[model samples]
Target chain A: MLKLQGIRAGYGRIEVLHGIECTVGDGEIVTVVGANGAGKSTLLKTVSGILGIWSGTIELGSTAIHKKSVERIASLGVVQIPEGRQLFGPLTVEENLELGGYAKRRSGRKAHAKLEEVYELFPRLRERRRQQAGTLSGGEQQMLAIGRALMAEPRVLLLDEPSMGLAPLIVKEIFTILGELNQRGLGMLLVEQDARLALSLAHRGLVLERGTVVLEDTGQALLNNPDVQAIYFGQHGGRRDSRTESA
Target chain B: MTFEQLLQYVASGLTNGSIYALTALGFTLIYNATDIINFAQGEFVMLGGLSAVSLHEAGAPLPVAFAGAVLTVTVVGILFELLAIRPLLRSGVLTQIIVTVGASLAFRTGALMIWGRDARPLPSFSGETPVRLLGATFNRQTIWVFGLTLVIVVALQLFYRRTLTGKAVRACSINPMAARLMGVSYSRVVLLSFAVSAAISAAGGVMITPASFMSYASGSLIGLKGFAAAILGGLGNPLGAVIGGLLLGIIEALSVGLLPGGSSGYKDGVAFLILVLVLFARPQGLMGGRIVDKA
Candidate 1:
């Protein structure tokens, strides 16, 4: 389980998330849904220790991990699949996975088993273990990013916009796999701009408006809430397809 | 010049090229990790050779003196890394450049005060013996330079490829945040780079002291040649440094033998030619990266 209390985070000189109060129950898929600049990504980034928190406390179980280095936070079993599928482009597919398990490997753990686990999840990654990661398709890169995080054997996986810029079918497949992961007892905090997919896949969901959490509910309830639909979907529904709300 | 004479000139250039390669290793390694060219690099070489000569003359055995020389210069490199480089890492690239350039100036001035403005050479550890290979006579010293540079490059290649720490360094070079997330201490890797790079440069100085005498101001051109070799090989590629060094050497040697009065005055121009021409064609270098990136 992960908890954040009054978490204020930002980039240099510009505050992104004013103050966030969020929680993820054990083995639950908790989704943070919002607009493009709703600070959803910033929340995950602050938790992952990439962006510094100005006034807040983040806890991984009982450990106060707000001040821990990014690697230390990761070793505590919190792995992040960074936004934009930031795989090491020049490295081979296998190397990207190996780097993901870097901290675990240093303490004399077996990387091969983890590597096998990753390959099991994505057979394409195994097929192109020798190929450069940069050469992979965008959807494949997203799978690679997820597979890379899985290589760490994380207790809590934080995925940011895994469906970003992907085809409809590929996004569905990725979301389906994520549902399977949640069903298999892996806890996740998924941050997505797509409310429909994120809400359905997660057990509970939090709606972020601007930098604040506007609402929190069970996935089914949020799916039916008109307030959730009006603000998040109010503008896009008029221009883009309203069917995206059901995606 | 006769074809045979031209070949001999290239042969001499090869010897000089090895030394340049070693010096450039210092520049390339530091640049790879921190992206700052440590102008003080040449001082490490000067200190190593001069220290060996001074220690030898003061009654130490040659091997012991060489060891002390290497250690002394390595410590100096580490000190510079700690005092001059580390504090300014987050302080902008231009500031870091100016700081390192100043450190090199300070070190050279300090050396001038200690050793005076005199060129000194250490007795070759392997003796003045020469061996004939393929009709070209080579001193035992030239063979040491060639063989030693080869050995160091091979050893470093293995260290980077097979060892955990070296891979960590490579990872850091590629992505510092990811490397840190993997628990690689950024400071430790940067220090190690300076240590290894300066040690190689120091060894280079000692190796060539038998043929090319050492002076405080001599480090400037030596550093330039090394930079050229590193650039030609690829700014950050270790194997490139070796290839670049040898190429620069052969070119310089050929120039001297081919031109009338070229050997005496044309050596420096040969290295410049390679540097200018290589940069003109492939500025990213043979390895395809710049010495500096857009800040």
Candidate 2:
């Protein structure tokens, strides 16, 4: 399980996440939905140790990891697939995946076995193994990003806007893979801009508003709530549209 | 030019080219990892030659002196990163470049203080037996320098392609954040790059010192030439640096050979001329891949 308690973090003096609290249990999918600048990306970055937490307790199981280095945090099984699919563009698909498994390189056979597992999850990547990562389509890059994270064999995966810029069909395929991975006992904290799609795939959902968690509930309940529908589902179309347009 | 004259020029050019290639390779390693153009790279070469000569004078075997020189310079490289470069990493590119320039001066001054101003002569690895090839004569040391360079280049290519740690270094070079997220230590990679860069440059120094006498003042000119080769080959590509070095050497040699009115004095100018031409025509270099802007 992964947990955050009263987490306060930001970039330099500008506080972006103000006392945010969240948790994702084993085999669960918890989604965060917010408009731009609601600290969605900031939250994930803090959790992953890329951004420092000003005050809070972050735990993976019984161990606190808030003060750990990024690589150490990753070695402890909390891996992040960042907002941009940060693939090494000039490297081949295989080389990217190989780097993803770098921490486990000493485990020779086990690492090789994990490589096979990743290839199995995204067979298209196997076929395009020799191609440079930059040449891949947007959807394929996202797949490679997720596959790269999976190579680390994370106990808890933190995903930031995995569906961004991807087509509807491709997004659905990606979410399905997330569901499959979750079913196999990996926990996920998914941050998404597409509220409806996130709610549909998540077991629970949190709505963040300007650096704070405004609402948290089961995904179905959040979907059914009149306030959520009004604020996030575009029922208040004029206000929501204007906000998105400005963003 | 006569064919024999051409062969002689080519052989000398290759020997000089291999030295530049080695120094440029050092530049490429550090540039790829930290994006810093280490001006002290040529100092590593100078130190290598002088230190080995001092050790040899102290009655150490040739291999021991060579190994000691490489090891000492490698330590200097790592310490340089820890003391000088790492602190200014977040201070942006201009500061980093200035710091390296300062470091180059410091290294040169230190070498002068320790080794004095006189040029030191090193005995060639094998006795200087000139071998005749295509009616042109070349020394055994030329063969050693070229052969060693070929070996190092091939070894480096294989290491990057076939080894996991080498791939991790490449990964850090390409995308440091992603590499960090994948449990690769960024500092370790940067440190390794420095060590490798210094060691390679030191090897170059050891190889070339016999042909060209070693002196504390030699680093500045050689370092600048190496930097030119790096830029000419596209800064981040190792193989490109090698090709650029060879090309620069050949161009300089040809200029000296063909130009009228005893143009040998203008040999050094020829390198910068090629550099200017390369910058104007194809700044990305002869073998440089497309430059990708990091996010």
Candidate 3:
């Protein structure tokens, strides 16, 4: 489980995340949907200790990790699959995955075992294990990014825009994999721009607006909310105008 | 030129090439890890040679002297990182560059104070006998320089390809933030890079000093050549750096062998000319691709 209370963070003198509180429970997928520049990525960075928290507490199962080093936080099992699928472009897919298991590298066989599990999950990665990460297609790169995070054997996986730049069919495939992993009890905190897709996969959802949590409810509840539909799903319930009406 | 003469030039060129390659390798390692060109890289070689000479003069055995020189330079590298580099990391690339240039000046000044202005010679690792090959004779030290450089380069390649820490460092080079997300400590990798760079450069300094006498000021030209090699090979690629150094040396040697009278004096100029052409024609160098920082 992960919890953030009264979290405030920013870049330089410009504050972005202003007094936010959120939680993701064990084995649950909590989706946070927000418009561009809504401080979603900043929140994840703060939790992962990549950015310093201005105020508030972030905890994983009651142990405060807000002050920990980025590496220490990752070793404690909070790993992030950052935005844009930041795989090492020059390195092979296997090498990128090996780096993901860096924290556990000294554990010897355990690390290798985890690597095997990752290979099993993404068989395409095994086939192109020697291929440079940059050469992979967008969907495959996303898979490698997620697979790299899984190599860490994370307790809570923080994903930022896993569906961004991915085709609709690939997005469906990735979400299906996420669902399957969730059934295996892997906790995920997903920040997504595709509100419909994210909400459909999540058990609970929160709507963020202007660095603040504007709404929180069950995924179905938020999906059915008129205001949510109006903003996220687009005009007229995201349906095309009828021919007679247009005429 | 006769075949023997050509072989002689190549053999001599390879000796100098190995030294430049070693120093360039240092540049590549530190640059890859921290994205900072450590101008003090040549100073590590100077420090290594000077320390070994000082130790040898102090009556320590040759092997012991060599180890002391490497260890001393390694400490200097770490201290440089702690005292000079670490503080400037957040101050942007320009600041880091200025600080490294300043650090090299300080290192040179310190070496002057310690070793003074006179160029000093190091005894060859083996007997002073010239080994005869194909009607050409070369110093035994040439074999040592070439052999040792080959061993170090191969070992370094293995380190980058086979070791987890090495892969993590490569990951850092490619994407520091993504490496951090994977629990790889960026600072630690940078520190290790500095240490290894210093050690390799120091070894070069020690090995090359026997052939070319070393003074406190010797590092400036050597460092420049090494920097040129790194740039020629594509800055961050280690294998490229080695090949670049060798190519630069062979070209310089060939110019001396084939060019008209007094052209040897223009050897350094030729190296820089190549560097200028590389910057103009292909700034990425031979092996360098455009590195996209996705993180």
TM-score of each: 0.91, 0.96, 0.95
lDDT over C-alpha atoms for residue A159 of model 2: 95
For model 3, the docking class works out as: high
Chain B TM, every candidate = 0.95, 0.97, 0.96
Tens-place lDDT per residue, model 1, B94-152, is 79889977988897898899889999978876878777777767777777788888898
In candidate 2, which residue ranges exceed 4 Å CA deviation?
Answer: A235-247, B289-295
- Compute DockQ for each candidate against the true complex: 0.41, 0.84, 0.84
lDDT of 1 by residue, A1-247 (tens): 7999999988888888988998888899999988667798999989889888999899989988999878789888898888787777877787777777766773344677778877888898899999988899988888888887776778899998888788878999898888887787899999877777788888899988779988999988987899877755555321143345445
lDDT score at residue A99, model 2, on the 0-100 scale: 84
What's the number of clashes in each of the models?
Answer: 3, 0, 0
**What is candidate 3's lDDT per residue for A180-206, written digit by digit as tens?**
999999999999878888988899998
Residue B83 lDDT in model 2? 95
Interface RMSD of each: 2.1, 0.7, 0.6
True contacts kept of each: 0.28, 0.88, 0.96
- Superposed by TM-score, candidate 1 places the C-alpha of residue A244 at a distance from the truth, in angstroms, of 14
